[model samples]
Target: MHDPIWQAEKKKILTRLSIAIYKMTDEQLISLLHLFKDLNLKDNDKLLEMPHSHADGVVAARDRQLLIARFFLLINQLSEADLLKFMNRYEQKRFSMLREYPRVPCNITLDLAADGRAINCSAMDISAGGMFVESCESFTMNQPVSICFSLAEDQLALKIKGRVIRLEQGGIGIQYESLTKYQIEIMKNMIDRLQRQASSQYRIG
Candidate 1:
C-alpha cells in the first residue's frame, strides 16, 4: 500500500532541498561540485551544468550521500530546521567507522542464551558483526551465548552463537563468532527489510 502521508512529506523535503540549493552562492556551488567528486557520487556526468542545462544539476536521481554533502557545504543557506537535520545526520555518520558495517536500528524479540539459561530479550539494533540486546540481566564481557529468532515473517528459524563483547548499562553487545553462509544471507535480508521500514518511518515523521 502506498502511503499518501509519506509521499507528501517527500514532496515537501524535495521542495525545501530545491529552494536551499537555489540559494547557494557561486563559491559554495563550486565547493559542492568538488565535494561531489571527492565522494565519488554515481552518475556524476549528470551533475555537470551543461551549456543548455536549466536546473542546478542537483536532481532527484543523485546519490543520497552526495545530496547530504551538498547540504553540509551549503549549510549557511538552509533554514534552522534543515541545518540541524543535516548537521545531526552528518555528526552521526562521522562517528561510524569506515571499515565497519553500519548497524540497523530495530527491535526484534529473541531468546538470549547464556550458561545453559535462556531469557527472552529485545534485539535493539543489528549489524553485520553483532547486535545490541536489551535486558535486565547482567552479562560479563566474553560470555558465550546463542541467539534464536524467527525471520522473513516467521517463515524461517535462526540460531547463531556469539560472545558478549561489551556490557552496557541496560544491555549487552554480542558479536557473532562464526556465522554460516545461510546465516549471513538471512541477516542481510533482515537488515534490508529493517532499513526500508526505517526509511518510510523517517520520511513520514
Candidate 2:
C-alpha cells in the first residue's frame, strides 16, 4: 500500500513528458496489454510491476488493472520515435498507429456521444484532434463517444465529441469530429502548457 498524497503530488510532473505521444487503436492496446502483463519488470517508483511469484491473488489482481492505466499513461507520453524503438523489440509483432495529433497523458471519463451513457475511463493521452481511452466496456469500432476530462492546470472540465476509430481489448481510439472554435483553443492551450512543462523539466534535469 502507498500514500494517496504521492499520487496527487506527482500528478503534474508525471503527466507531462518530453516525447511524442500518440493515440492507440483498440487492436493495438489489446496486444500491448498482453505484452506488458508478462513482462518481468524491475520494481520502478512511478509504476508498480510486482513479480509474478510475489503477486498473490486479489490485491495483485486489482492492481494489475490499475497498472494498465499507470503503465499506459507512461507509455502514451513517450515520443513516437521512442515508442517505436521500444515496440520494435517485439520483433514478432509490430505496433501500429492510427496517426493524427500527438497525445499528452491525461485522465478523464468517456460518455456516449449519441445518448450520453457515462463510462468511467482513463485517458492514456490526448490531443486537439483526438485521444486514447482505456476501458473494458463493450464498444464497437466506429462507435461515437464524448470525452469529459480536465486539463491538469485547469479546473474546468472539457467535453468533446469523437468517433471510435479503432478498438483493442483494454481501450479505444477516438478521433475528434465537429470541434468548436472554443474547444480547439482549449486543446491548443493545454498542449502548449504540457510542452512548456516538459521543456522546463528537460532544462532542469
Candidate 3:
C-alpha cells in the first residue's frame, strides 16, 4: 500500500505531466501516444529507440529527444495500473483542450463510412482538429468513421478518418485521426478562407 502523502504527490505529478503532454503540438503528441502504446515498460532498450524530432535546429531536436527519454524513464517507474491511470488523464486533458482550435461554419456534404455502411451527412462546422456533422443517423461513441468530401469547385477530394467524440441532439462531433502534414495544411487553408468569407459577410450585413 502506498503512503497517503506519497499517493497525493504521485497524483499531482501525473496531472502535471498530463497537462504538459496536452500542450505539445499535435504531431508530437501523436508520436508520444504511439510510443506509449507500443512501449514495454520492462524493456529499457526501447527508450534508446525514441524518434528524433524534426525540429529546426540540432539543439531543439536534442532537447526534444531528451525530454521524451525522461518521460519514458518516468513511465518505467509506474506500475501497470498507474500507467493506465496516467493515460486516461492524458486523454481527458487532450479532449478538454481540443476546443481551443478555431471553428467555422461549413456546408460541405460528406459520406461517413462505418461498419460496412455509408451514411450521407453534411458538415455543420469544421476546425483544424475536428468537425461537427449534422446527421440524424445514429453512431456509437468512439466509433471509427471514414469521411470523404470535396470542397466546392475543388477537383481533389479529401479522405480522412475520425472517431465519434460527442453526440448532440441533432448531430455528432468527430475528432480527426492523426492527420498528415499535408492534410493539416489543407485544413488550415480551408479554415482561413472560411473565416475570411464569414468576416466579409458579417461586414456586408
Candidate 4:
C-alpha cells in the first residue's frame, strides 16, 4: 500500500510545516504540541467520523500517524538546551510572580521617542512583554513612548509602542503595547540566542 504520490505530497506538507513551526513563538509551539497530543488520544472511530477529505478509515489512520510522526520528528530535532528553555518558560508561565515572561540580559542601544523628541537609550534586559531602558532622560509613569531597535544577531529592526510602567534612578521600565505575533517570535529568538550565549560563557568561566 505504498504510494509514491502520497509520499511526495506528504513530504511537501512537512517541509512547509517545518518552516511555519520554526517561525512560531514558544507559546504557539507548546499549543501545537497540546493539539497533537489531543489528536493522538482520539479513537480511530472518532477520527474517521471527523470532517476530513479521507473517506477510507485506513487512509485516515495513516494520515493521523503521519501527522504525529512529523510533529515529533521536528520536536526531536531541537537541541537539548532549546528544549530545556522551552520547558523552563512553560514552568515560569505557570508559577513565576510579577513577570509573566523570562528576561534576557542585553545591552542594545535604541531610539526612544517621547514628548516630541527622540532620545538615545540602551536596553538593560528584554522580555517578550517588555524591557528596561537605561536613559538619563526623565519619563513620567504611564507616559507613552515609541522605541526602535535592531537585534545584533540578525539586524532585525523593530519599532514598538510602549508606556513607562516604572521609573527608577537611571532608567524606566517599558511595557510593550499590542505586540504582533511576528514581533514576539523575533524577540523570543533573540532572547534564546542571548540566553544560550550567556550559558556558554558561564560554563566557560
Q: For this target, which candidate reaches the highest TM-score against the unseen true structure?
A: 3
Instruction: Give Cα-based local distance difference scores for all models.
Output: 0.65, 0.58, 0.73, 0.67
Give the 10-residue window scoring lowest on summed lDDT in candidate 3: 52-61
Backbone clashes in model 1, listed as residue pairs: none
Model 2, residue 154: distance off in Å is 5.9
Clashing residue pairs in candidate 4 are none
**In candidate 1, residue 44 scores what lDDT?**
44
Q: Over 4 Å off in model 3, which ranges?
A: 5-26, 30-73, 76-100
Best by lDDT: 3
Q: Give the per-residue lDDT of model 3 (tens digit) for 49-165.
A: 445444431224455546655675766587757666766766665575465458899898999898999899899999988899999888899889999998766468899888888
lDDT of 1 by residue, 124-160 (tens): 9997668999988978888899998987564866898
Clash statistics: count for each candidate: 0, 6, 0, 0
Q: Residue-wise lDDT of candidate 2 within 1-205, one digit each (tens)?
A: 1457644534433343211112333233344545544443444444534423222222233444564576666554544444445455433444233232457776555444445567877777778767888888877777777777766545777787678887888988878765555666678787777768778888999
Off by over 4 Å in 2: 1-101, 108-116, 152-154
Which of the two candidates, 3 or 4, achieves a greater TM-score against the reference? 3
TM-score of each: 0.51, 0.45, 0.64, 0.53
Arrange candidates, best TM-score first.
3, 4, 1, 2
lDDT of 3: 0.73
TM-score of 4: 0.53
| Candidate 3 vs candidate 4, lDDT winner | 3
**lDDT, candidate 1, residue 36?**
37
- Residue-wise lDDT of candidate 4 within 123-152, one digit each (tens)? 999998789999999889889999999886
